[model samples]
Structure formats: structure tokens, C-alpha cells
Target: MGSPAMADGYINGVPVDCYCTDKQGQRIEVGETICLQVDGRMFMAQCQMSLNVPMWREVSPGCLSSGLTAPLQSVDPSIHTLGVDVEIFATKS
Candidate 1:
């Protein structure tokens, strides 16, 4: 709705992406620091949407089948205790 995740108004800017998900595996708002962990290295970015919507449109068309794997953890500023665990990836295009 607002500016898209990337400057060009695209969500899948990188071959890989990260997300902060709730207990039900639903994505929440992008926090102050959304972190992704791949190969034990962490990458951080900002999320642009709220958790109220389903994220079907945000996904890249071929991303899932393109060797994408998620092992992520993101810091939700809304939570005072701990940062939420998220989806990370192994991606190639």
C-alpha cells in the first residue's frame, strides 16, 4: 500500500528474503530490525506491511521452488521480551 519493499516498488529485490512470523507462522509487521540468518551470518532489513494482511502477493513468482530455505530470526520492537523467530533462506536465481 505504501512504498513497496524496494525502491522500484518490488518485494523480491534480492534472490533471498526474510520475514518475521507469528506463532501461527503468519508474518507480522516489519520491525525496527528484521533479521535473516543464513550460513550463520545475519542480514537485516525493514518490513513495509502490517500483519493484518495475508502475504500471498508479496512473494516472488518462482522464489519458493528456486532453492529457497528459511532459517531466520527477527527483532520485533513491539515485543519487550525477545525478538520473533522468522524465515531465512538459501536463494539463487
Candidate 2:
């Protein structure tokens, strides 16, 4: 499962929580997994972020890691305040 990250920010031309950060405190310039916990079920999203605007909403739709590339169920807005480790790339997972 991926870590919990905010969808409303940016790090190095990418969405803050949806991209990888390296030890040099730099954004890895690559896509990453954003995990979402909805109603006790964890879903994964494959993200590729560019700008920090509506793109955050676009690349964050979760899909299964394997079968069926379609998106998972929509996230319930009621479950807010997801606590995740915020780090720049290069930090060990």
C-alpha cells in the first residue's frame, strides 16, 4: 500500500504526495502511488502529476494494482484528514 498524501499541494513541479522524493530533498520527477483508505478498504492509485491544479484530481483516481486498469470506487469525501508521512524523495520506505 502507498502512503497517505495530500492532493492539494506540489513538490518540484509535481503533486506533493503523489510523487517520489529523494534524499537530496528533491522531487524524483516520476509517478508514485497514492493510497486511499475508504470505509476501511485500502485502494491504490497510479499517479502522474504535472501541474498542481485540477490535475491533482485527475491523476489521483485509484485503480487496482493488477487486474482491470479501471478506477476503483470513488473516494468518500466524508473520510477526511488522512495522516501520512510527508517526506521529500530519497527517504527510505
**lDDT (C-alpha, whole model) for all candidates:** 0.41, 0.44
Instruction: Put down candidate 1 lDDT per residue, 1-93, tens digits, no spaces.
Output: 445444333354532244456436666554433344445654444444443332322322222234434532344446653443443333455
Question: Candidate 1 — number of clashing residue pairs?
Answer: 3
Q: Write model 2 residue lDDT over 1-93, tens digit each, in one string.
A: 233234445454465444454335555434555554556655554344445432212234455565533333354435642433346334785
Task: Look at candidate 1 and give me any clashing residue pairs.
Answer: 69-89, 70-88, 71-88
Q: Stretches of candidate 1 above 4 Å error?
A: 1-26, 30-32, 49-93
Score every model by TM-score.
Answer: 0.22, 0.22
